[model samples]
Target: IEGGLLASPPPHQYEFARLNLTYVITSKRKLAQLVYDHKVNGWDDPRIPTIVGLRRRGYTPEALQLFAERIGVTKSDSWIDYSTLEGCLREDLELKAHRGMAVLNPVKLVMTNWDEVMGVGHLEPCSQPALPHAPHGASSDAAPEGTEPPPARHFTIGKEVWIDREDFEEVPPKGYKRLFPGNKVRLKGGYVIECTGCTKDANGLITEVLATVVPDTKSGTPGSETVKVKAAITWVGVANGVNAEVRLYDRLFLDAQPDAGGKDFIESLNPNSLKVITAKVEPSLANALPGQNFQFERHGYFVADRVDHVQGRNPVFNLAVGLKDSWGK
Candidate 1:
């Protein structure tokens, strides 16, 4: 009211709107506290609800727009569940993200029959769809429609490949489909193998799993289509794979309504929200540029860190979200 006329507002005022997302608070003071109190890594932590944080976590603009559309414009205060946002992200990424393999908490799998079949130290060539869901000419990496897709990106595999340590168990529960003594499984995009057994150190910790390749079971080979297996596991060849720092992010708060019921919101913090691991990733992943997104097949969606990733340097990847359903309420 500088000169008796309100300069910024219209003659008629509009009602205010409130956005209440579950498990998130839009309070600057509280967010600052989280940073200063060492409750979070920083303002850009993926667990935070700020726009900078969301961008760093690989949340796409399309997904945010979809979320806004689904929620519409609410007059009264409303709480939208976190899954609603995640669902939009999943939908957006399903068709846009490239697929790759990465193994966190890796365990060595040695091909006992490799030397006999492929010769000692031989590297076998393999390829995967660059972007299975991308439309014609949509990505710079994509081949033009109707053109023989450029020879699929090639990767090499030796006698050893790394698999997720959790993929095996001494005694599996009901319906377990991964590796175990005498069990058969397909090495995704590679070969079918039957577990011979595993070697353990003095501490009873498995050091290496031994498996024999089933002849003529290489995917895309003549007999591969006919040979069916209970499970197909992802692997990163020791000779061709690259090591990367991967950060797994989970829900920050354990409670659906952390600030509800007069409870201290900080008390609901999830202790295991971020876990860092040295992961074995496909050779191509080492070239992943900042902001590039990929689906770490069977694991989750991830992105090269915008600020930390550099070609030929140690690349950092952040788990955008898991392939599983919701992160609970």
Candidate 2:
């Protein structure tokens, strides 16, 4: 068999290399089964371990390189936890990714005091640093002593802003610092608001949270830094926010080693792996181009879907990964 094609001898042959990334299967037959059986959306699904999938999920080239360096060359087969890759991505993006607000599970927050300050239908100006931790045009240590920081970029606010539903609690849990009756919280890049109460529907679901804005507490304004709050929350102005479809991608399999011990991998499929939700994003995000990545403050890193995103139309985003300390063991 080896001598049949001697006339056209191969120039070079290389040994096959393998990566032992945990919680992912790289078998060609298994991957084909996943696509054909429709267990996953497709071969490029963000939940899969394919290169195309990783690219679509906002994995950067530098991050992948860092991962390879950390994993190094090894003769023996060994497994690396998925979190190692996630950490690499975080390190790569921490300094580069722009900061933006996106409320995945939004709940209405009506500023009852809005009309008092800005008048009815008026849009209030708000600003936030494009990159929160990193200084603009200068490295953090290079800034001269006693010099003020650069101003943040501005956005608009209205009578209402949408906050993550999880930020509020009808019954406060221990150490909870977010919104509740009489609790004051600063809206990131906006004003400090004191929760008066909340309105509920017949079904006992919170319809809208009513809050009164603290006087002269708009961020960057006089007295803004003086008024301290235990918690600061992210929000998107209802009038200025862009509605987007965000897909939260979690682990495909619940078991860490699904194929270990001769177990059938299909049986370990996680049913709640992908969740589609409508998110309220900042107006700036409306112009997000395909493959643009952002850190959705307090939520996770997400990217505009390269395949489905369309400018000036409804945009689709996929979650890349959450904060390192976000998940519980």
Maximum-TM-score candidate: 1
Clashing pairs in 1: none
- All predictions: root-mean-square deviation over Cα? 3.6, 5.0
What TM-score against the true fold does each predicted structure earn? 0.89, 0.89
Candidate 1 TM-score, true structure as reference: 0.89
RMSD of 2: 5.0
* lDDT of prediction 1: 0.85
Whole-model Cα lDDT per candidate?
0.85, 0.85
Q: Model 2: how far is 268 from its true place, Å? A: 1.4
Q: Mind giving the per-residue lDDT tens digits that candidate 1 earns over 1-329?
A: 67777676647856746777777666788789899999997988888998879988989999999999998875776778888888899888987688888998899999998999989889989988766655543764565567654334568777899999888877778899999888999998899998888899999999998999887888888879677788999999999789899999888888877776667889888998899989999978888888888899999899899888887688899999878665653
